[model samples]
Target chain A: MIRVSRYQLVLMLVWTVLATGILTMPATMATFSVRDTWLSSWGILLGGTLCAGLAWCHVRLFPDRSLTAAMELAFGRFAGKLAAVWVVIWLVITLATICREFGVFVTTIALPNTPEYLVVALALACSAYLVYLGLEVVGRVNEFLVPIAAIVFPLLFVLALRWFDWTPLQPVLADGWLPVWRAGVVPAFAYGLEFSLALQWVPYLNNPRALPVDILLSAGISALVLMGLVLITDGVIGAPVAYLNYPVLEVVRAIRVGKFVERLDTWYAMGVVSTLVLKQAAFQTGLAEAFRTLCGTRDPRWSIWPTALLVWSLAYFLFRNSADVSRFILHTVPGYFLFTAVLLPLLVYAAAFFRGVRPASRAGAGEARR
Target chain B: MIGLAVGAAVLGVLFQGWQAVRYGDGPGAGAWTVWGMLALAAVAVSVVVQARWWPDANPLGWLAALFDGITSWIYLGWSA
Candidate 1:
């Protein structure tokens, strides 16, 4: 199929992880770990990289099969289909939740006059179109967008140094390591394990052997950026970061370079939106592929529109407002994602090993039989 | 709001008709039919909600409220 360069894959992974977390990570972590929020991020980085590494091993063991096909090979046909269905449902819900998050963020912060449904509808339209274009287009688009984010993100950090206060992060481990551990769970599940979605793209990669290294490198870079944002938000905004809904947005809003460079929050918003588009494209593509596996279809393009509509409807009517959305994100999403992303892979890997399933010689050919 | 709902319903029906013609009895025809029906139903419900036809009978709102209630109970450890 669709082939993507290692560089494209790394950029896609980094952008997808950074998309939604960048805005809320600091505040969410601060709420739990307080001054030790940055430390908690380190735990997330390590956990996420480990999860990626585990996924790499699984892919290496079964180079031909997508995660869904591998599940079938490991657990037999019927049971594997059931597990694959669960993964697909998880992916669909995740996509809906992400769309809801984006809609709420835009309506609350950027475009108050717009209806949430309208914003979500437009986003779904764009993302669905991108998904229809296939993985190659998505990879290239990410290749273009990631560089802008890479440059602007660090520059924003540098400019905000005027407001950086290291005193707020003082007395490290004041509450001991438990709170930090608890705090790390949010980012660990939300950002780290999300790379599980990358498993779907393994077969499409040009050089499958490099997938693990690329994923690890991307996870490390994303972790550093996330940690930097948390540090800056906690330091500049101090303890109050715990109360702010979007601490990173506030941090960007506070940066005033003379008069011309003020209101850089708009720039930050643009970057977040770009990353979100890429993330949605990735999720939508994965969902389509999952559906194809389920329906025994060769093309997933026809499935994209229906899926987009379904996601839009669910995201629109699923929650009362942003508060409910946030509650779902904090309470429900972590556990749900952990089960699908971390535990499911481990289970599949164990099953595959116990069954002694050999790696296929040609990708997709063996998978087509099952 | 009612006008918007009506417009959405019409647009959804038109899109589905196009899809049905374009992909006649193809791989995704069934999906197109199901989604088209859902889009229409969702818009109709929105219209009803906007019109306040049943006053207190907004199913989508009720569903959201019910979910929130369940989540709160779970968060609060099911206090009696």
Candidate 2:
């Protein structure tokens, strides 16, 4: 059993904040059919945090068993298998999309000469190897990288102070609230808001009761970081940010603090690598857990390679290019996140309420027998 | 397994180089070329190190992976 302190858990959340996957969202959010992009972006905080809260509630209800196990209990054997397959497939696509996006970002800004596919393949491979090392190392690495991001990002924000125009955010509700809501889905699903991945590893918690606090705290922190990004990006780039493909990168490029150590985009590349790895790890963990529970693995750690290969193959085939990948994620992932992370848990909790499934009795040790 | 991963990584790198040469600033914009090579190299090294050399040791690979996801979120959140 890998032991992780509360501090380490918090560090994990902070790393999630730094993920490159979320970094790419502002560009998508800008196209959100709304003038008040920032407002719509902030709206995700409410929806996302509520989803996190629901996850906490489920953990409280199921305690020992994970969300996957709870689904099996609530839905029965056949449907449970169906749900598991959907989730596993969902996670794989999510990983691939993010991997492809990371590749796109790198090639777009840093290395224009590099092949985008190579970047995608390399990112997936790197993330898979990292996942294969197991969770404990992942946690500690978060502890290390999270601080760097926490410091660097704020510093970047501050240094870009001169370029900021507070007036751009005015007339905030200029285009009604509906567009904002539509835009909110992009960020809500795109970021670490899909806390469904938490269900996979929740069973590994040494003290499951303490998990509600971890989940809530992590969710809150992620939202705040997100809000900071929205506000800063808007203030810095203005409304035209919505029109650009890589708004944040462009904004960073636009920052020139008067000669000597400008072009901070390369430094930002480190931040990108950190986040891509996190996204891959979370999805891979979910995939590994599903395999462990369903297939009865002799060694759970051994599952990462085949899973990586599976994701690599799928990503290679799923969509011809980034635009197709974007379309699939934009249309499909939000509803899926809404269902898996929030609705499913709530339904399960409601069932647990009536069916009398004790939360404390759901442990892996206990469930292994069933 | 490590050897296989390394070989795939090498192929990925070669492919990346080929794409970069063939389609300089094409629509894919060389994103595939660069990231593909990186994915292959990084995955190959980490797996070889973990699976072969220190199979039981928990090193820092997992945290590195999770951090990747988190950074993506942060990037998207702040980018716009």
Candidate 3:
């Protein structure tokens, strides 16, 4: 019912494309990955892109409806509902993880005295309000915010150049590709988080023809940003970056540009806030859509409270703490995301191709080719 | 309502103490920011809770909620 321009959608994506995924989790990952963190980031990018491409193929296969509808067409009623359930659970988990991340960052850096739950509650209310306004507002806000992030991130590094110690990254790839590959775990699947919303983004984009390309471009741009951050942080702080609880904040704190622009992490914190807002908004909107599908309703506004309350309660129990959440992500979530966002779509796309049953003319791949 | 308010106030006091313990050490004075953040958190908890109960209720409630959301990162190790 709401119209969103391709530019707005792409902007929304740019914010989600970065920090919320790999950069947010890199502190834990750097412990395992070591100095090869930047290279590993690229490795994850390749893996996530393949998954996104596969999902895009499925979207192409069923243009009129989303993955939920496509599943109904491909499998019967029961299996379709099951697949829809998986998608919904994935989104709910994503929402909760982001909320926890919000709390972790706040308590660790800015508000040590505050109750973690309070910070999370504040984040949730903002996201709920955004979802209530509909995707268009979310998209426009993302457009405004993403560019500020893009500008500030590089500026953070430039300011840190005064403190740059190139020796730490010197033994680059010293531990070999094994550690790098392991470290890339966080960034690799980070972009795939956005793929969870393919069901929603597919319908709203002004040019479905350009959607995949834009996603691919967004992925590439975000990957570069991750690489730059990894390289700069590693170069500045070296292995100590891995030890710090929150590497990005540490990197910002390390910046002291000739005494005039000290304590810039406060500003860098704004970038963090903006990215989390966009990521949370995207995930919640998708969650709302899935609820609409499951309950057989066209109205998302009516179900917002139930969905928010459920997500809040679920996030409460999902993981024991930030460390537990990080461990779960390190060990399990990537492969699960691969199956849902990557392999399943490919399976469906191959079936459609082999069956000689042509999907709509302007669906995913068809439009991409045009 | 007062019970909840008192509970939040107690949390505020604990938070301020926690800030003093964590970042409120001698030399840096970063803990002053911590005190400010604790105050912000108290305001945030009240605001967010109110919004959840009765959204679009009052402009003051809305502003407090927004402040908390945007400033949630103010207390982190790097955020301040």
Candidate 4:
């Protein structure tokens, strides 16, 4: 079993949440709750914390097993297998969507003439290789890259402060709480529910007991970063943020720190891509592990290539363009994710409670005593 | 585009076939075969749709439309 420190896991989760959410959340939130977009981010933080708390409880209940194994323990053989399969499918789809979004972002913002599939293939190839190397390498890569993101992200926002206008965020909650609630639901489910995926990693951690704390810390940090991004984007571009494909990139491009600091979008892109790699690697690792656990494969590495290829194909063919991708993220993903991330955990915990399932270690001790 | 699709289909089949032969019969091997077949089928269908029947029949476009309709319905009811 590969062991990763809680710090590494925290960094990995933070990068995973920030890398993707930063670029898209602003525009998505602004679309629904124009001036009160920042409030939606707070909603994500709170919702994510609740999801993370539930995941932690699930992990504590079955300390020795993965999420799949725990599901089997809680739901019984056939039904648990069915649920596991569904979760695996959801994980695969999430991986594909993230890969697709990364490809679209890179192609649209940077590589205009290059084919989107090529970018996706290259990105997936790198992430697949990381998955093959195993989770330790993924954690290490995040440890190295996340600090750079941490530095560049704030600096980019601060430099863009020159264009910040308070009027756009004025008359906060002007649209009533309903739109804010709706707007918050997207990011809340997208980023918050991501902690549910992290449940699978708990068994591999050096200190699983620290997971809830790490989850809360990562969620808090990511939420603050997202809030900053939304605030900066809305403050800088105002209502126009909803119109731009990548409001963060646009904000970065608008930054004119002195004369030489112009066109920092390349730097910003590098940071984003680093996070993308981390996110994709983390998801790919989870997918490979899920395949190994579900299919009874001898080696998880064997599943990595097949999963990567499937992700590549799906990402390539999933949406007509980025707009379609955005629509799915906004309109569809939350509901699906709520089922898997929030409701599924609650169900598993309730089932485990009723079944009187003890922690694996305690159960083993009892068996030995008998 | 046709060549690319055909190439992807052929490559997927070959890759999966190689894995099945190397790994022998197991769940992993079966999964490889299934994924390979799915890829092959997807590409083959895309080629048929785009190259022969309708010149502008983008498989992804069709998929996007279907997905959008389903998701919109799920989230906002039929009126949306």
Candidate 5:
């Protein structure tokens, strides 16, 4: 059986959540809560912690199965298949959007001359290969890249201290807690809700006993990093950040020490772009796993490339330009995430409850027989 | 370059799937049938949406557009 150590597992968990959030959270949060983006990040903490808590509860109930498999036990065969298929659809479009989102960032900012489709295709290609190799290999790659992101992101924050201003964050909660609650209610929760993917791999962890602590650390760490990024991006870029698309990029672009080291957004993108690709890979892995369970596939490998193809197609056909990508990310995505990650799962949980499923339910172990 | 990459992906999935089938992880007909269809769907992306209300007339997009309204109402009806 494939196995990953806790350290690798934790890093996979961290990057799976942080890779997308690091780039967009500051500005995305600013779009709603404005100058109080930092305070608004409390939504991320609470929602992330709660979302992680939900995943933790999910695995606790279905200890030996994936989300689809757990749903089979919780709901029953037909309903479970229906729910899992929708989850698959969610994975397909979300991965498509992630690819498109990152592809736009890369072509626009990093590789100005490269074709966007090519960048997206290259990412799906890498994902197909790593996913066929399975999560252990993907975990190892993340072990290296997450630390680079961990270090480089913080280093950028420290270097950008030259432009950090406290006045922008002042006039705190001028609009009261409603906007904070609104920002936290959906957007931040959706970001944390990405942790839903981690539940798919929990049953395979070699040391399964430490699962909650690992998830908690992952949640706490991801939330802290996002909140920190929000603080620095808003502090450095000020109120304009609310309207700007890539606040963190501008923060890094603004750095200039003795005129020697500016234009470091390229270096920053170098570290983050891998994290983004791996994020898509990581999501593709879980998506394929869910696909396998629903299809009764002979092996996990059957689903990888085919799923990659679906995502590539969706990435191409979904959005027209960066504006379409941004508008979808800002408005459409959170609710869709709410559907698959929160509401759908809660419906299954309700089914489990109505049917007398418990945290210690042993229905999980024998679920594969179905 | 794109052709080579897509070809590699197709072959890579075949190789990986073949290994599992050889090991008798399970049998192939049903799984491979579905895989072939999906791979074909991916390769023929432009053809899939040849004529539609919008160029992006994906079934997945339809589902998202459908349920997003329902779920958004469920989640955002009172809050946010």
Candidate 6:
């Protein structure tokens, strides 16, 4: 088996939590909360922390098992396989959504006139190679890419600050806390509950004890970045952010400092592509791992290809339009991700307790004490 | 004859330089080649896993074996 350090896992989690939400968060939050857009990021912080914290407990219970394997530990073999199937299917659908969204954004923005199928296929192919190499390589690749996002996001925020106006964010809580909470909580599931996928990386962590802190820190950093982006986007573009499909792109297009810094799409594009690759690789790896467990196979490398085919087909062929992708992410994703990422693990934990099943390591520890 | 010539060229390009043509040109195509080789290596690895693990049956035949044991393994527990 391959091992990854806690630091690597945390880096990957930050991408998982932040990637898809970068462009969409500002618009979605502004749409719901208006001037209270920044207010909703608090809900993001809370929702992300809580979802990850629950997954932390799930990891604590099954230190040595992947999420799917833990389901096997809780349920009978057949039902365990059923649970694994459910998780695999969820990963497939969600991954296809992310892949399709990636295709839409890249083809529409960066590489127009290029075939969408080719873009999606090539991207997934790269992600498949990362999966084939296993988690350690995936973690290292993400570690390399993190600096790109870390640098680009803050720099983008600073450059876009020239347009920041205080008026747009005024009258905070005009609609009170309800709308803010509603706006924040929904996107939190979109960004936060995905921490559950990090639980699959738990068994690979070199320092298992560090998992909780790393989990929270990753989500916390994501929330902070998300919160700052929302505020900056709102302050810079004001009420118009609500209407823009990609507020971050608008924020990028708005940046103009002398001749050199005008419309820093090149910088912004790097950030977008970096996060997109990281997120897709994370999902593809997780889906392949869960799939291997389901098939009772020892290796997950080959399985990545088959799963890539499914993701490619669903992304390019099945999903018809970019609007459908947007609607699905906004309307459908929160509840769907909540069930699989949060509630399913919680149920599996309950089942573990009901069956009086404990982690093998814990049992060994108890025996040692005796 | 011209249509046939064009079709042959297209097929040859797809077969020989599919990675370059399918992905793009320049650095992008180079990145595609590196990952494309890795993807092909993964397909090769799957064959190895198949031969090593399930020489008698299909690669994913664990479920098939479990299906036969359905009545016996209905009750749940560790490794049940």
TM-score of every candidate: 0.83, 0.76, 0.76, 0.85, 0.85, 0.79
lDDT of 6 by residue, A172-231 (tens): 777777667657755576667787787676556777656777777887887787788888
Tell me which of candidates 1 and 6 scores higher on DockQ.
1
Model 6: residue A245 alpha-carbon error in angstroms: 1.0
lDDT, candidate 3, at A27: 75
Consecutive 10-residue window with the lowest summed lDDT within model 2 chain A: A293-302
10 residues in a row with least lDDT, candidate 1 chain A = A361-370
Q: Where does model 1 exceed 4 Å of error? A: A368-370, B1-80
DockQ of each: 0.11, 0.02, 0.02, 0.18, 0.23, 0.02
Ranked by lDDT, the better of candidates 3 and 4 is 4
Please provide, for model 2 over A1-370, each residue's C-alpha lDDT reduced to its tens digit, 9 standing for 90 to 100: 7755666665565455447535656767767642466665554455456656766777667776666667666666556655665565566667766676777778877789997767766776777776677766667777777666778877877777777787877777777776676677666654545655666776666665666567667766766776667777778888787777766666667667767768887767778777677767767776776644443333345446655664564454455566766655555555555556666677777767776666666434554222
Q: Give the interface RMSD values of the models in order.
A: 6.2, 16.3, 21.2, 5.1, 5.1, 16.2
- The residue pairs that clash in candidate 1, if any, are none
lDDT, candidate 6, residue A255?
A: 79
> What is the two-chain DockQ of model 5?
0.23
Per-model tally of clashing residue pairs: 0, 61, 11, 0, 0, 0
Candidate 3 regions with alpha-carbon error over 4 angstroms: A190-193, A258-260, A350-370, B1-80
lDDT by residue for model 1 over A1-370, one digit each (tens)? 6688998888888878878888667777776767888878875576567666776777667775578767877887678877887887678678877898899889988999998889988998999899899898999999788567769878987899899988988898887877787677668776777777878876677877777788788878888888888988988999888889899999889999887879888888998887887899999988877755554445666567766776776574455577766766666666566667777878888888877776676544544332
What local lDDT does model 2 show for residue A252?
Answer: 69
Query: Which ranges in model 4 have alpha carbons more than 4 Å from their true place?
Result: A362-370, B1-80
Q: Write the per-residue lDDT of candidate 5 for residues A1-370, one digit (tens) a residue.
A: 6776888888887787777777777766776666676666655555456556666667656666677767877878667766777787678778877998888888878788988878888888887798888788988898877567667777887999988888988888888876676566444556767877776775566665566677778777776777788888878888788778788888888888786877889888887788887889888888877766765554567768756765675576667676776656655666777667777777776777677776553334433332
Residue A342 displacement (Å), model 1: 2.0
Which whole-number lDDT from 0 to 100 does residue A197 have in model 5?
Answer: 76
